[model samples]
Target chain A: MPGAETPIETIISMMVGRTLSNDALVIPDTASQPVALEVRNLNRGREIRDVSFAVRKGEILGFAGLMGAGRTEVARAIFGADRRESGDIFVHGQRVSISTPKDAVAAGIGYLSEDRKHFGLATGLDVRNNVALASLERFTSPIGVLDEAGMQREAVSYIRQLAIKTPSDTQEARLLSGGNQQKVVIAKWLLRDCDILIFDEPTRGIDVGAKSEIYKLLNALAAQGKAIIVISSELPEVLRLSHRIAVMCEGRLTGILPGGASQEEIMGLATLREPAMAVRHAS
Target chain B: MTDTTAPAPAAKTGPRISGAFHRLLAFSGLIALIVAFSLASPNFLQTQNILAILQATSVNGVLAIAATLVIITGGIDLSVGTLMTFCAVVAGVILTYWGLPLPVGILGAILAGAASGLVSGTIIAKLKVPPFIATLGMMLILKGLSLVISGTKPIYFNDTPGFNQIALGSFIGQIFPAVPLPNGVLVLFAVALIAAFVLSKTALGRYTFALGSNEEAVRLSGVNIDRWKIAVYSVTGAICGVAGLLIASRLNSAQPALGQGYELDAIAAVVIGGTSLSGGRGTVLGTLIGALIISVLANGLRILSVAQEWQTVVTGCIIILAVYADILRRRAL
Candidate 1:
């Protein structure tokens, strides 16, 4: 039912179902419509040109592109990891400006950065501390008082839930393997209650077993009606996990189609940028 | 969303219990030294000799603790000696020149040290200069300023004769009056305790370790590494301010030319105490012990009638050995 999206023209007539609020706007039509997220003329500029699409709840929005093809930029811009010059982003039809990562977190958007070792963790801190870092306010009193016991318990729960290979939450994050570190990243986002999750190269550098575990987690998160965007350089991954695929090339959106679209069609759109732009220039 | 998860206990690898025991082995060398020294001389075990050693270590130990924080952050401060002297001179100016109260003079000394340290942090963090070079320049500037401020002469606290009581007055000894330990020893311990608290607790302390571990990693995590680095330098500088107060208090005068080579001694104490100069691994207790080691060596040698020049050579050897031990430990880690 979320998959059958009537275009924005229909949504305009459905304004009677919208509720006004200060920071959060709840649209009655979009709320009950089963679509977790919808982007109407989502313009991220230079890289993403007049790109528009609708992704139903619990469906993965797979962004596929070659290296430096603006796919990573899209993830970054939407997650508020990087500021976009101009764009309209909505979580459940509530328009939001994500100027900073803190803002994104408050808006229930979580971004898993590709560079996990550097951006994702404080290695000196134990695994438990790293997991509790993002949502530290929840575990801490206003005056910088950290409830070590509560934090430790929460960390242990995440570790068990994720099946991470850690001796304990007390073990330093520095000592963990690559796959375990990625698990810690996922646990961090989940603790923050992020409804819209973005994973950039989620399985990069992970071994086969760990990759399977991550895929399983992604699938499970989707089943719970979380809006997911996965940007991967790997074609097979895009094919396997994506509900819909958006192919990009040379910093511009070339095509969008269902996940079942043939690789040949996506490849055709990926190479569409230069020839079409060159032709336009000549004209 | 899945909750069915087991807390997989980490598999044991290396000998856990032995590693901790090995860390406790730093005292073995000191024990051997004590046994050898006691056998060589009767006075080596005397209370007078012990007090003398502690008093001698008081200045260097305080300076060492200051250096330990910087060293732990993978940084070195070459200007500590001159910075200490500059602090003393500033206090001297406040006490004698402007006729300020004793407390103001003490505060002035520390503030002077902090101001210069702030400059060093700014140059290194904002201007992107290496810590070694930036602090080296600061050392020279402060050294020159000490002379200029004091007109190449000693500034005595003779006008406020009671000023000597800060470090010279042994409040602990007076309470007991049996040992009559100098107040300087108490100051050294207090400084060490405070430094330990700062290094082990607080957010600034965390970032200090993080900056030394991987600075860019910290920056990418959205932490303002620059501000923290500056704070580290300021803390180090504030400690130097304390050192200046102690030195000036002990000498009873702010000698313009007195603080030339103290930085080397402070760094030596830090290294000998087991703080890795390469950063990311250090402890305040290690630095305290390191200061004691330097002073004990000096005192033991003095009691054995070792020449002043030989004492310098032995200290140099110990410093090299200490740093080499650090390198080996780092490689092993």
Candidate 2:
């Protein structure tokens, strides 16, 4: 029982080597900032209801929900990775048509799927190729031949910038750890010049050290004016990183709260069943 | 926190070493087959016999390369043999039946292959059909079509003066005077070189491996996955066309019934070449070496008066051994 008396926050702080106070971080004020992504009544069968929300430039929008609350479904619908029954996605105040992930990327949106192995990283390919995968056309000549040297140079630079721990750019992605693999996925979106990024469970499988790094990286990316929506099941993580939190339950947006909203408040909204009650609580 | 969990550089070397080791094992196997054959019969290493082995490999080697492209994308092409026959029939119609020029016939056959491949790709990618089933259907369709087109008979290229020379004549022999390597082998080498280069240096090649590695990942990366998949299949079909021309030219006829069993051999060669059936990991060189192994085994066995049935048994055993070896290598890594 020696460590039983200690709080979870203290243990997390010890593991991450960082203070766990909300006061230590500066949350961005997005009231005056331009809206980077806005969705109007997004619907995708029974998985997602008429969900509408907006994230401003330089804002980290934390999506909070229970295990089956359809948070990932909403994100995938917005990113066009999954088909939506009815939805309108507006980027930079302009409505965009997105029928596929290709169209979403063309509209400057990137999605890092929660399952990295299945939907984010091509484990067999080397790091250089994965980093440049999203933006391959930039590295290709007019004749469709890839400029290998240019791709290598760009991959090496991203490896340095993202601090991806790999032996070389030529190292296959599967060999890297969870944290580094996440960084490689981040690097891919970054290299693609995607201004709007939806990261689903960004730190799901990462260790304490890499989780903090990813947190810092997300903060730094938001500071650079990237509109980020991080979908995480961990409430503390949502509270630690989000400027505003959006809570969902049973495919409906139960409520949206500020970053400093208490755990009890989020949990209340998370389990709220009635839409009428959610509207009252949201207001 | 410090990044203490990163794998050590030493740990990363395991796969690279084993990849090289696998290729080395395959190459040594090829060499061992040759040495064994030469020792068993003095006639096995003769220049004429070697040329005959190369000639036999030309058709299967080209088909295997085509299969390599598709297999690397985590897909299989079972229609390669019949598709080859179909293309040869197309070429026969152009040159022998229509009496068109030889260049036109050659171009026509290649284009025919590409078109069939496009159809297969569209079926697989757009219809969301599994590659195995899609290509299996294509195999039967093309087989029936080949028989129909050629009227269930061999379409002879006797009227086309240089048609037989495409595979039989040796351009290198013309220059070297002593080597006398057949043009079919030259074509095989040329196809291998181009396929290897495309797999290494082009966007298509990169996507091929990426699609096989994690197709959903590639699609999520904003790539047009269907387009690329279709393209891979189309290219595969075109390679099969080349194989068709080689087979037709070598025999001086388009034999519709001759191509049904060739796919098994091509796929066997691909497996023996260290290309994974599950997709995402393989090489053109590995496939080339594999094709050579098959022909060498077949030719060497015949030279030693081994029965054809037993030769097939040996080949079947070799395929299983090659795949098992691959599994061991992967598990070790």
Candidate 3:
């Protein structure tokens, strides 16, 4: 009957029914919806300026910038790793003040620092302790004694789920490979039930094989309905993984584009700084 | 993270072997010291001499335990000695001057120590002062305060009945006459056991290790590091209170000037126990053994009629050798 319908009727029906038939391929549903995290006018007075971006739920927001483009500064500000001069942060459309990393975590935001050895892990602690580090309160008794068995069980589960390669859950974190260490940090945040994860240089020192594994993990986390922000210097990595990419230049966010943007286009936005001649008077 | 291309299997065996070797080195060195001392002085092996050495170890052993916690957090507490004196002076004030009950005096001394430790911790954490300089300043301050509080005179606890019994009296020996161990040694064992349990089992204990291992990482994990740091110092201060109680109980008086060099002895004991002064690696059991080694060395040399001045020199050299040994062990790993 539909095939026998008139040309005008069929054209109208196709136009109206297109979304219902192929909505999954047509667009990402959350792209135009409310954002999970928003940063506005985050200025640290010296290193950062007027950085603004939004990451919707179930999306991977890639931050692509050069070495001195203030990517880390912005991330630190958002995570409250460093004090910001002025900024407004919104989590799930609700404005909140983040003065410390504790406040950030309380607001369901987690930051995995670029320097894994110094800032992302306690190298001397065992794997189970590292996984339970952030969410220790969950396994702690009322009198402050840790539930060692519960922690060990949870850690082992994460190790299995994440496929983190370690000899045993009791192995000291420092003894693990770089990729495994990164996975441990990720497991820590996940155990804390954080919905928004900011990973700074996720694969900085990881091997090629582990890099792919980490990529799979990030996608899996996004599929689990968590918003993720990935900061990377590798353009191909950013382009390949991001749903949308934001570019920064000289402490300011210059532009944002779709994931499929050309490499030349991204590089152009990444270098869009103020003219050198114009800076003479300002200095 | 430095991506070491070294094979995982090789790296694994290296640290394991070195760990066992370091423990063996420390234990054997202690045994060797005891054998050498017994050969030098026949009295060194006698039970009375052993009891005397243990009695001498009580106060210093307690202080060394306090030092162990601070050092494991990659910090030094130079104020521990003077803090002990201050606590003893407070106990004197409560028991003699205020004429309070024995329990009140004990509690008073502990509270005073905790309060002072809190001040020092706040100065270090909030003011961003380095532990060495801050505790050094605090050490001087407490030293001056102790003297001022006690009027530069020893406060005798003659009025307090059974006060000396706190350290000298042995309930264990009363029950089993053959053992004849002082109550102070029991206190040391109790403290070491409790500290070891806490360091290995509790959230507070884990934080202490984590703070030493990587403070920034802890902060990023949403932990209130400053509060935990203050707690560590406070716990140290409370332990110093117990040390104060032991020393005052032994002497039946609080001597403000007697505490000037105790911090050095305590720190030396901690180092000899193989606790890394750089932080993160230490154990209560190791600290207990270290305390014994120091006391035994001192007692043996004294029994051999070595000059006190020469004894001091030997102790200094031994401390250097112990730390050097630790460095060598770490380098081998």
Candidate 4:
């Protein structure tokens, strides 16, 4: 019982120390089983620091933080939108190197950005094209021509399944409401069969009706055994939708709280910050 | 923000309706120009003058189509004019200087142009240089290279017999004697049609629009944006090579000084054709019509004895008006 009796704080500090170097810290194989995604001491220069957490399949993990607290940066690093200085990312218990969004998508992770206008949807394209944007590889022939019929059929099915209230599949994405646009982006990643989706500010600009729809969609996705990480600045929304909550402050994970925690409890964790260890290490 | 009066389904037809409306407006503007020009000069309506206009549009039209592809990817190619000249000089070296076959010259020109575009694309995509600055550098570099290679003088293809036939000869003219449409115009038509088909039907075209619309979105979608960007520029460059072939065959020479202002003209035509300079939306047919409008205006003004300086002034004003029209349309949307 000597090794088994190591304190949790000691294990965490070991992870923090090992993260400063390039070595992947050994993860304890426990009876609980590994989650869909597990990050140990993920470091990205100054932007992200010793950030580590886990979200299992069929669970919604809410990430709550103040602006510039590195919640988005952590998500970007995990999804490979940004480069990490050191860390290990395990997707479904397999250590994976994701250096770009392309790698992340191939690894079955989808990210819905906070800024939908610029980073989430191509506003000028039709709904079908937007939905098919991530999945074009599936609809392409050997000669590099797109299979229009197949794309349309799949898009139409998603539209019906997701209840995207567009008039038809050919409707342009920009014309759709904020919620519909978000739905189209959801449909896009869903059709691509991404097992883990990171929704950053999922209902930011959506109307009340569409916000509820998105919540329902997220619930449905989770029900289907997909892992979801919702990054929301809104405490109430996060508490309502998440099964568990991870809080960050000044680029570090302060604590992971249980679901339905009071706003004050989450805020207390979110404001908890330690002195910048990255600067100390740099000097 | 809480206004729920507008249902989602009703707004669905808005894009298609507005698209058709904009195209119709541009087409009517083209028609208006034609009507105005015909009223100004009787000779403008003549078949000879119309053919001349089409011949004039051939080079610029092809170049405009090339520019359209680049612009659709939210990028630009200012080097297209000099790149076209570079292609022509490469062709001259292969055909006239080396005494090689015509096909070799054609292929050489296209390959050289594509190579130049690849370099420019790498600068833009890999180096993260903005398209305008990168293409501008490429323009100056290519222009200097063309001048240096051609010995700072025209590379004349006069010794190459039947070279002019590539542009001037017309099979359609043989079929219908009265039409007398040049092969240059036919080449422009062929290029436009193929470009249109590619833009609408192929994965490349889809990515082109995707890149222009939201490059970050496309990149995040797991597409290799850099590779597609390079491919788009290469296609644009190869098309510029075709334009080079057209101009060189027509003039029987590659004049080093003739290409500097052509980039502006091609960009102007693209903007006038309703293709947004910011990228994301365009059509080959719009570009063809835009090129025709420029040529027709130039030809008609010449027939009316209007001064060249005034003609330039009018064209500049037209470009401003076209962009203003675009702004108005987008604002309304």
Candidate 5:
């Protein structure tokens, strides 16, 4: 019975728990928006070779590629989670030097890594602590003592706002579902007030109901004018979410397509290898 | 659509209950040891013998506290024992050989310890050397340096007045005239209280657990993890400096060769106190109780005329049991 349901019906059922009139997915026109982040000729060994792109304000720029196509590498380079051989990153038209994740965060860039267990969540710590970790200075006194009550208050607020299904803020992060864990990561960046968010595999292991919730959350964040770059291997996810799509193959950005581009168009560019137009852009 | 069942929320009180359970288990074990020893030997319950056990625990307790900080960062400082000796020798050179003021000598020892710790931290953090190997190398280097600096001789604190009082004197007896607790026990309690506060209430303590729990995650959170790790090691070294002073003042001499095996005792105490050897979760109170447990076991067995070798065997058995208990607790979780 579930297999017979249409994709829209499933999403709708997951959203409201019942069927409703269809609302079209609006593709925001980001052409006139200011460029929030721009990378010029970013190079990182062989995995990322002279790759460049720009993400504008209020835009969901989806990165599409096959496995090992260097999409994650480019995200890491831009976020300064990895050493970049050479690159110029301009945030809001000002070039900022970011060599470490600390500098990247100081420059208002947040990276939600694909490896949630190792790089996104301190599973042994509680949800409140994890959410407050990136912004601990705000909850710390001049004498370096933590304001635990304040942290707990903020954590409870985020739990309610994000609909995180935890019994309490003190619940250990490892015990939470994958979707809730991802929300905790999102709450961390939100608390840090990061302007540029790079989400790698935002819904990789999440279930369908939680997956729809994440999609809604991402669209809401873009609606709030946050610059979001989503790197997902799922073509339908890219098609449904991105205002613009960037396709990569063999460490090169093969092409950029507008939102609503056909799956065949994305697949074609995903497998394209150093074509003349792609070569010209690299130079 | 059929796969939309909500994930079972974790038991609301699981971790909290288990944490309290572990501390209770350790505490009850300590109490059981005290009772058994008291029943087996009449002298074990005496006030003097009790004071002796507390005094014996002082140095190792302080050192174990130091290890707790580093271990919570998922690091091991094998150099803590020799580093303590190295600090004592530095104090000796300042107080006896150089004829410096007592305060200066004390400050010199602590600063020397901090500097050595800073070096160890830099090697591990900046050079990307693993913590175990770096500290192991530091352990040997410090042991050799202690012998070289002290000229293979014990450095006496005869030139420093009131030095022996630093550990042997009883400030509480001077106040109440009832309980004559040694200054060393007082120092242990003070150190434990301060360490507990730091671990619970300070940002440094937060990062210590975070680093152990998931270091890469902490780094990706935009934290300067290297700086924090280095700070943890430096603080640990400084605590070892305090331990050095306690031992030196207790004996009125810095015995260079007397420190090689002390590290094992300190680590044992930390493990028995319910602090995870793998890091992340630990407590200073647990360490203090752990140190007390070791001291009690040693003193009780000695009172009952157990051979020193058998005492060591018993200790080895306890350490294994404690670690196994921890593994079982984690598995239950």
Candidate 6:
């Protein structure tokens, strides 16, 4: 354990002593066993050196950083809504290429985008339809006829499962409150059997009571061994919810730390930029 | 400050009064027209005048019902007018030139309208063109096609001797000789009843409102919005086909020039009857009332010796007033 810090401490002390170039901090493997998702050497050929990380099953891996940190970009990349110039992504130890949101779903990956109102739901549909949308195949017959009764029964289960406060499944989504909308989004992914979940800015505008419920839901989902990755701007949220925390700065992974790590430690790594070191490599 | 909430008697009475007011307005409009027209001209009270009004409403009312479906989906079908005309021309071609059976001619006519609607729907849905642009293009296309097909002349349905009877004949009148209501009126009512039922009771109907209400929400819900949008246009098209049959039968000919302006009248009737052009809220009953209002106004104004140009101007003004009134009501809500 002491030996682990020796190299890092030596590097820091060397930089402090010589006031040398703020670069060449050797990085170590941050991923753990039973990898849920792994990105290895993503876009290594570009100006921005490709980095890698892994999320373990049943763990809340919180991603925290300041603005322009590429935290949301990483989440979007994994969700397949954004392109990775070159990277090998493995879901449940199986390498996969996801080019679109539909592909991500097919791989049992569910993404709750930051902008839930626009991308996550069809606001005009009733509660039941939004819940059943991603799983329409289960509700329709071979001949393309909708089984209304079957769909309704399944919807009732989700409404009960999510404890969605609505008169019935027929209540339109637009009529529901913000928290209810978030729950509906969760219910959609849950219905789709998505084991790997990416939640970005999960409680951005949700009220206090609803935020508590969402935290509880995330904990519950993690307890069930779902690979959960949360992207957040809130410090307390990242500190409290994560089992491990990953810090990003300037579109690069600055460092990874245990969840119990202090805000100062995370911020120190986030602001740890090696400007001349990157420039030195260029020369 | 202490009164957090209180239901005043007057506040509670408002909704009931409003409901009653609308019904009263429509019912009274119909009655007042009948009474006034009957008093002004003895000829107006005659069964012939009554039948004539009903007959006039049949075609426009049916088209309005079709337009109601499209408008409710937050879309419009401007081509419905020429599409109807094109359908009639097809029917005329089938009956008079191709020498097909009367039933076949009717079938051909309806299918022709539906096919055009399907094309418009495809252009709008699959091509990602807005409904206005797609349907506007379709309107012109159908107009040109009709004129070219008919060679800028009316095609008489003389070869199919019984074709005119489809509209002018009165089976219901024969059964109940006291009323003598034409079969065309009955057909119109039958179509309206069925359209209303489909809109209210079917999954397609619910989605129609859903599309107008929030199309993206519907798509996120995993509905094939393109397919549903196409279905709506196709249904509207099929109804247009029905309107074409009624019109051609009524005139005993397919007049290409007659359909170039009918869409405005149908749309006006729908709006006047209380259907919102923005979609999400509408009723077949409203379209019926709207159709009757236009017919009564025209019949009454003609009796009052209003010039034809003045009648057109009055109709235009009424459309604006009706739309403005709707805006006021929405703002009040």
Q: Pick the candidate with the highest DockQ.
A: 2
Assess every candidate by TM-score: 0.81, 0.96, 0.93, 0.91, 0.95, 0.76
- DockQ of predicted candidate 2: 0.53
Binned by DockQ into CAPRI classes (incorrect, acceptable, medium, high), candidate 6 is incorrect
lDDT of 3: 0.87
Using DockQ as the yardstick, the better of models 4 and 5 is 5
DockQ of 4: 0.29
Stretches off by above 4 angstroms in model 4 are A1-34, A275-283, B1-13
lDDT of each: 0.76, 0.92, 0.87, 0.86, 0.90, 0.78
Each candidate's number of clashing pairs is 2, 0, 0, 0, 0, 3
lDDT of 4 by residue, B1-333 (tens): 112222354563555666656667778888998899889888889888888889999999999999999998989999999999999998988888798988898899989988988898999999999999999999999899988888888888877877787789887999999888999999999999999988998899999999999999998888889999999999999999999999999989888777888999999899888898888998888888788778877887888899998888989998898888878887787
Docking level for model 5: acceptable
Chain B TM-scores, listed for every candidate in order, come to: 0.93, 0.97, 0.95, 0.96, 0.96, 0.91
lDDT of 3 by residue, A61-178 (tens): 9999899899999998898889999989999999999989999999999999999999999998889999998988888799888999999999999988888778889888998889
Best by lDDT: 2
| Per-residue lDDT of A167 in model 5 | 87
Candidate 1 — which residues are off by over 4 angstroms? A1-59, A70-111, A134-147, A191-197, A221-227, A276-283, B1-23, B330-333
Instruction: Arrange candidates by DockQ, descending.
Output: 2, 5, 4, 3, 1, 6
Please list the residue runs of candidate 6 whose C-alpha ends up more than 4 Å from where it truly belongs after superposition. A1-158, A167-172, A188-200, A222-231, A242-283, B1-48
Per-residue accuracy of model 2 over A81-184 as CA lDDT, tens digit each? 88999989999999999999999999999999999999999999999999998999898888779999999999999888878889899989999888899999
List the lowest-lDDT window of 10 residues for candidate 1 chain B.
B14-23
Task: Indicate the residue-level lDDT of A245 in model 4.
Answer: 89
Q: Residue A103 of model 2: what lDDT? A: 97
lDDT of 3 at B82: 94
Per-residue lDDT for B16-116 in model 2, tens only?
77887888889999999999999999999999999999999999999999999999999999999999999999999999999999999999999999999
DockQ for each of the predicted structures, in order? Answer: 0.13, 0.53, 0.28, 0.29, 0.47, 0.10
Per-residue lDDT for B1-333 in model 6, tens only?
011111111211133344344435555666787788778888787788889899999999999999999898889989889889999999988899889899899889878877888899899989989889999999999999998998999999887889998889999888898888998899899999988877765667767776776675555444567888898899899999999999999999999887878899999888877777777667788788888888987887797788888888877877787677667664554
